[model samples]
Target: MAGLKIFGSDPENQPKPRQRFADDVVGRFRAGHTIDDRPASLDEWRITTGDPDVAARVYELFGGEEPQEGAAKGEDNIEVFTAADSVAIIIESAKSLRQRMVLWGRSGKPIYVSDGEFILDENGHPTEERDPDADLTFQERKEKKDIGAVPDIDLFFRLADDPDLGIFLFKTGSWGLAYELARDDVQGALEQAEGPVKAVLALEPVSFKAKSGPRKGQTVSYTKSSLTLKGAA
Candidate 1:
């Protein structure tokens, strides 16, 4: 908590970096994360918006090359244009998003519900003949599974509507913020996010490796590296 507070203040006091939290939902959306529900002396909005290495990796995963010179020149800091509210977050990477959805669907924690759709005939109208390509199965067809854009969209929606905590929503534009692997705190967060959409984080760990030799069992290491978050979603 103290770390987050310190982090929040560090960014605010500086000569507004090229990337500051502008009062735009796009900015806010760009710098998206769950609202800090925990009590603290001061509330600091967590942001994750920079890191060339992370940007390169995320870009690679999302089907784009790293930005060239001056790519993020003006958009140094995020601009939160809209107030906190329910919003649909669209992750642009089709392959990566699909792979993550499969991961979350298997987790069984943040139950992923499939949305039902109508069976249309060749004329593009609902017909007695069921469309073989419909997403909904017979069982799901009876109930609209509340399906939306992509898996991340549904996951973010669930996070925002979490009963135990509340989170704001944001859509991905251009390229989302990237985090480097820094400390155990961030790693732990990633493990927890195994269930659904994870927060936008950036960590730059000097070194990271499994504690035990690579085996046929789950393994992990520990660290206490400092974490620096740049911005939201």
Candidate 2:
């Protein structure tokens, strides 16, 4: 008898861009096309497709001379926003007190979280579901029968320089430090800020195991040491 099998049990296979390109090249080769005399290498192809820096790095790895400083704005040139940079702190909601720190790039688009599994819509914009408790006031939540002790506030931060680097969550101790640094401003914003606020964030890199989610045992880094409020919107 044929072995039993579960349909769709295996994860969906998605090919990377390079893999697809390689496959295309193989197909051409099988069709009696010669690639040995091609002018462009795989790295050159990558450079033409918006990854010149990666190509440069690969060249250097193969004993090529290092490119001059500031010659290219690849991975090395990404600027990590420090406490010196003013960040736009958008209070996304009053009920959830959902806060987001935004940094605008020179290109006029928000730079953050280019990779990682964030809930996004078909148009490639971040999307969040409407919270069921969004309509409830804080006091109402405190009085609800099913509600337990308020869940610990979890804050996630994305690096401004490289969006594809993924996001980091604040540690519990770091959360305490941030509270101490901007307690009044945070409380005030939650209570009365009408829109986005401004703040200067002081962050220290930290690594810890995730407390929840499928990634519980995995280590993750976060910038969550402290924050200072600049002003309200």
Candidate 3:
């Protein structure tokens, strides 16, 4: 693994970063085309191909670095390329895609379920298995000991330029647009990856017909991040 220095030790013992949402995020763009190089059906606003103003704003925010350019051209750069949906940067270091559960209440507030302590395998790697000491907060709150738990995936990230930003969580799991994260390609990258996976992340707009919902027959549009992983770090 001499050339595979992409991973590091645990991040918990290190410092945390901020989450890029709303104004904090530079911007998300729909894939101009599919991975095969075909034209995409992108709407107007979500398009981040290259508007002069948008480029200017990006340059201003990033100083020397720009979107047209990939990212820091340093040794730490992993040069990753994901054949999955599409994507960007995240702050991490030898961490698991640690999953938790969530239970919704009548008030519609989300209650994050305890993942308990992750049970590591013989190799010292994390497993979905948990300790029997699971927190009972969800049971107490729902007033039901047998409440069902919805699985959740929490991904934390921060921009290189914005180090002061507190670690933000990108929560998702087997749901609509969020489901893309679970794809084999993207999930594989997360599984193989180790440290702060920073790269040029882009969000491509996607439009499709709803399958089994009230709007089953209606057309809906949403955005998906373009995930890429090149060679090893």
Measured by lDDT, the strongest candidate is 3
Residue pairs with backbone overlap in model 2 = none
> Worst lDDT window (10 residues) for model 1?
94-103
lDDT of 3 by residue, 1-233 (tens): 36543446776555455433333432333233343555453222122212334444434543432334333243212211223232334545425245544555668765434443554454545578663445545334234424544546655544455544334334443233333443445556755675456654445566899997789989998665443444333
Which structure is stronger by lDDT: 1 or 3?
3
lDDT of 1 by residue, 1-233 (tens): 34344434576665543542222222222322333654221112222233443334323433322333322345434222222222322221111121111112344443332211343333434546433325644334223324321222211221222212222233331111111222233334434444443233222222344555654345542221112322233
How many clashing residue pairs are found in candidate 1?
31
Which regions of candidate 1 fall more than 4 Å away from where they truly are? 1-26, 29-150, 154-168, 171-215, 220-233
Q: What is the lDDT of residue 121 in candidate 1?
A: 38
Q: Arrange candidates, best TM-score first.
A: 3, 2, 1
Which structure is stronger by lDDT: 2 or 3? 3
- Local distance difference test values of all predictions, in order: 0.29, 0.35, 0.44
TM-score of 3: 0.38
Best first by lDDT, ranked: 3, 2, 1
